[model samples]
Target chain A: MNARGDTTRKRLIDATTALVREVGYANVRTRSIAVAAGVAEGTLYRHFADKRSLFYAAVLDRNAPIVAATATLPSLAGRGTVLENLLEVIRKLAQLQEDLLPLEQAMIADPTLAPLRGERVQMPLEGPPHDIARYLAAEQSLGRVRAECDPTLAAISLLAMLFGLAVHPLLGNDLAKSELLGASVSYFVDGVGASATQPKLLA
Target chain B: MNARGDTTRKRLIDATTALVREVGYANVRTRSIAVAAGVAEGTLYRHFADKRSLFYAAVLDRNAPIVAATATLPSLAGRGTVLENLLEVIRKLAQLQEDLLPLEQAMIADPTLAPLRGERVQMPLEGPPHDIARYLAAEQSLGRVRAECDPTLAAISLLAMLFGLAVHPLLGNDLAKSELLGASVSYFVDGVGASATQPKLLA
Candidate 1:
């Protein structure tokens, strides 16, 4: 926590970012990252537990936008219309996902990296969906969202849709992203039932 | 085209299955597959245009349950309750995805195998969603689904949820699969709107 230690942490993360961009995640190694950062290989172990944790820290630092947006989720629950708040969160998640695509592909390619992920393996399960579910539950308490609606499933559905939308372009599936998202969010908010009343989203 | 050619094609496919299972998709090569099948490496090119095509054919062959379920989609248009038919398709997709998980992970790991997938890259874009969209449109025509609903988005949402459910177990996200799925489909069919009428699904 000293200035010297903080500087070392920053240097290690920066080195990981540079090395990951240069060699790709599948090819990156702890010693190489240490070498790139101009530190002893043992220094990496001192600063971080493993390469996966190091990379996760780097990703979190890089994707501050999404992290910040997700943190503000509960505050937004009672403020804006539910659909608007949900869309905003999803939009941020999509942007973050777009940035993380290469890293995700690389991680999937390297089997050794999987077990190193440790606690981070459960991060995705606890991320935006968890926040969104909480937000929905809050809104339900406020009488904005339907009380009987299962917030967890709804949150998962929204998160899944956001993931699908984000990966669609990456996989060469051509979709009018913004337009389709608007429609999808509208559908989610209003439901597709014949008798369901559609709410007008704020501009 | 001839009996001899048919035998060769079957041999090549069988070879791919054995090789994929033995060495994994990231390690399988056309030459190794040919060597395993006791055929000239060039015989593989004659049977299939490339390794991706061969893998695609193998996946389709192995996933007969999903293909058969999908093929029966149109016949279910007005035959059963819309939710019943939709859940049936989703259940089949979940099973197929679970079966194909290893291959899917393997393919994601290997970059070289990507471009060879050709039109199959757009397979998800064209597969269950395409059929489901058509079925939903038909239901809309029959006054089952709301006419105002965007069938494409509905289909995509359902497909996305199905994919999430499929990958949840693979990624160690714990949810009661059937229960969560039932809630998801019900929410999709009835919407989360308090005013929406829910349908009774056949067991």
Candidate 2:
């Protein structure tokens, strides 16, 4: 596409995102999206296949930063202390979930978005959890982590903690913004068993 | 109310739960709920203030088992091994989250349910997380868990793990049905740090 076409496409995605946030996926109409983007209805179809496609594009566009941050997790495996690497992982995962959850909930509730759900392409062994697992496995090999621990399960546990915290407020509890992240990372790195004598790593 | 009134109210709640599960919350009508319950439309209103109230009743009805389970956690502290208590906690939390999440997403997406959202009564520092924290504190006092570990943060972390696993399938990832619950409980009871020399609690 030319520079003008690219600009129009970006505008459409931005408008769709804002409208979805304000109203909801079920109520958002393609015509209103075009109007919000200052483009013709015909132009929206010219750029994307359907409303679902356009919405998918908007979600992906919004998620680009998180994807980039998750991609960087594996490389940090042997470069830093495992505690430091996991703290960064938890921070990024929290941000990623916070951004994606509303959009995901909207998709689940809207029948029109069913096609997008069917088309969901999962990388399976290549998300943040998998990346963290790979990092832990590497750390285990380097003798930084316990040899008996299951890296995959540990990764899932870590991911679960962050995801749980992200959705806690939806259940009417206040978002726990205390020293939870640091404390969790510290607990994870140094086992909570009475015999485990590692000094406290986080304040 | 008399036995007949109790039976009628139970029928209405059961009908509402079935209908809401079949159709999204936005699409469910009180008229349909009454018909499904084999009662007059006036019957539903007589039993409840509005559709939101009926829906709330249904949610609470479904959640009673989880509430009962969560209520048992604090009393179990120091009665059995700390590991055994936590394993039970993870099991109950995972079940609670799995059942509550779909209803929650529907509530979040539908505008008519906005009033119900505001009416959410939280027990604040008295739910499962708090209960588990109390248990941990009791165990810490008994010298079963490390003194330096923060019980509140540790409780939060354990809850986060189970909640995360419950929601993982929503993102198109297959529900991880491996030995995750056992693994997480073991990790929580015994930290993953290299120097933590407790025997692995779970296989």
**True-structure RMSD, every candidate:** 5.8, 4.9
- Return the clash pairs for model 2, or none: A191-B191, A192-B191
Q: Kindly list the per-residue Cα lDDT of model 2 for residues B132-184, writing each as its tens digit.
A: 88877777766667777788888877776666566544341323334777787
TM-score of chain B of each: 0.67, 0.76
Off by over 4 Å in 2: A108-126, A170-178, A191-203, B108-126, B170-178, B192-203
Question: What local lDDT score does residue B192 receive in model 1, on the 0 to 100 scale?
Answer: 23
Q: How many clashes does each candidate structure show, in the order listed?
A: 0, 2
lDDT of 1 by residue, B1-203 (tens): 99998888878877887766555665577999898888999888888987878887766666555555677686687786777887777766766565454445445445544534335453433566778888888777666776578888778776665654544323313333566666667767764212334342222
lDDT of 1 at A84: 80
Candidate 1 chain A, run of 10 with poorest lDDT? A192-201
DockQ of all models, two decimals each: 0.30, 0.45
- C-alpha RMSD over true interface residues, each candidate: 4.7, 3.8
Model 2 CAPRI quality: acceptable
Task: Write model 1 residue lDDT over A1-203, tens digit each, in one string.
Answer: 89988888888988887776555665578999898888898988998998878987776666555555687798786686777887776766666655454445445434444544335353343566778888888877776776678888787776665555544323314333466666666667664222334332222
